[model samples]
Target: LSDRLSRRVGMIVPGLAGMAVMAAVLGAAGWLPDGAALVTLVAAWVLLAIPDGLHRSSASALVVEQSPAPSERGRFMGALGACGALASVLAPVTYGFTAQAAGIGCTFLLSAVSLVLALGCVSRVREASSPATPE
Candidate 1:
């Protein structure tokens, strides 16, 4: 599903994923009541899963699209993979510590803010990379 979406929408697929992530994190951050929290958490999990799928499909395409040459692609992708691995390792640890200090609701709110910032960065990169047309 994400592969097809990425083929059509390209980088926008990840942008949408970022938005979904932000929404999910925000939803998980005490927006729902006690009885509804479980359902909301489940829905947030689904929302997070969408982005996970979209990212895996879209990131490779982005590597291909952004690399200046085929020879550079391997190095670019390697770096990308390393960064992803680092983030995966670090994020959970950071979230755990943050939750311990500030509580789960605040941690989720912080995650939502981080996603929003990431979306803004993606949008800027997209705009900068897009071709300019004659006036």
Candidate 2:
């Protein structure tokens, strides 16, 4: 998708937002009654993978194209990788605690919140770094 277009942010944002929406739906499904819950969970699970894939691919492509100057790309990738590794190490514990303390549904809701916040951070960084255009 990124190869076919120039707007990496456009694709990345919607992909993540779609992921968040489906995650919220899945979370809400956990709170629904039996048959409805089963149906929703099935549907959401089926839909979830698409946006997850889209976000992963587009975001990675964007990182490559939008990261700092050429000299800093390696450092940037290293930092990004370190952050991802940290998240990998911490996420299971966070999810387990959150699940134990506040039902599994809450974990998805928490992830939705986190995704939104992360998108906001990305947007702010992109905006701050982008060169201003003349009116």
Candidate 3:
């Protein structure tokens, strides 16, 4: 689980980096109004989702490239699919609550903090050694 988490942290950074930049740009430009804010929020979601779409395409290419033994490939893909499903179920709920409590701008800030924390762990093993162990 720790290894998987570490691997996912790597995957998340690129997308989150882009999100942070976008959020900063939008906030600096004073782009948030009720309707425009909602539109921007949806656009952010679509942008973030690009990584997932890329991952699926990459995974498909991997299966084709590796040409794994029949059963193993199916099992590998199935586990990957299950992990993705779990993320899909949990992420929106978590983000929705955070947005409700802190507002979307703060949510973006929180996400940036999380990304920085994740990257710091890579650079400082002490941080990586401790499990996140969500409360």
Candidate 4:
């Protein structure tokens, strides 16, 4: 479902999901009442998961689409997998220190900022590679 959605909308799904994550993260930053905090946390978690799932599926499909040849596709996918593995390993340690030093709220804010930056980079890459359309 998400794969088809991604194909139709390109980066918009992930981009919007990233924005939702930012909003939810900000909401989870304790502006709400105690009762609402739990709800906000849950909502934020769900929003974060949406982007994660969408990104993984879309990125995998993009890898397959962009690979030059069948022979190189395996290597491309393997490299992508390696990058994901490295991120999984490093993210926890990085987040722990960041949260410890900057507080959890700041950590969430930083994560949102990173998401925005990533979205911008993806947009630029897509624009550069996309074919020009006739007026």
The best candidate by TM-score is: 2
Ten-residue region with minimum lDDT total, candidate 3: 126-135
What pairs collide in candidate 1? none
Q: Which of the two, 2 or 4, has more lDDT?
A: 2
lDDT (0-100) at residue 114 of candidate 3?
55
| Cα lDDT computed for each candidate against the true fold | 0.64, 0.75, 0.52, 0.64
lDDT by residue for model 4 (30-59), tens: 666877877777777766666676666666
Cα shift from native, residue 15, model 4 (Å): 4.8
Each candidate's number of clashing pairs is: 0, 0, 0, 0
Relative to the true structure, candidate 4 reaches a TM of 0.74
Best by lDDT: 2
Clash pairs for candidate 3? none
Model 2 per-residue lDDT tens digits across residues 75-132? 7677778888999999999999999999999998998889888777666545224432
Tell me, what's the RMSD of every candidate? 5.8, 5.0, 10.3, 5.6
Each model's TM-score, in the order given? Answer: 0.73, 0.82, 0.45, 0.74
The alpha-carbon deviation from the true structure for residue 124 of candidate 3, after best TM-score superposition, in angstroms, is 16
| Model 3 per-residue lDDT tens digits across residues 1-135 | 222444234443344455555554434323466787777766766675665443345444343333345446667777767977998898688879987886656656666565556445433422234323322
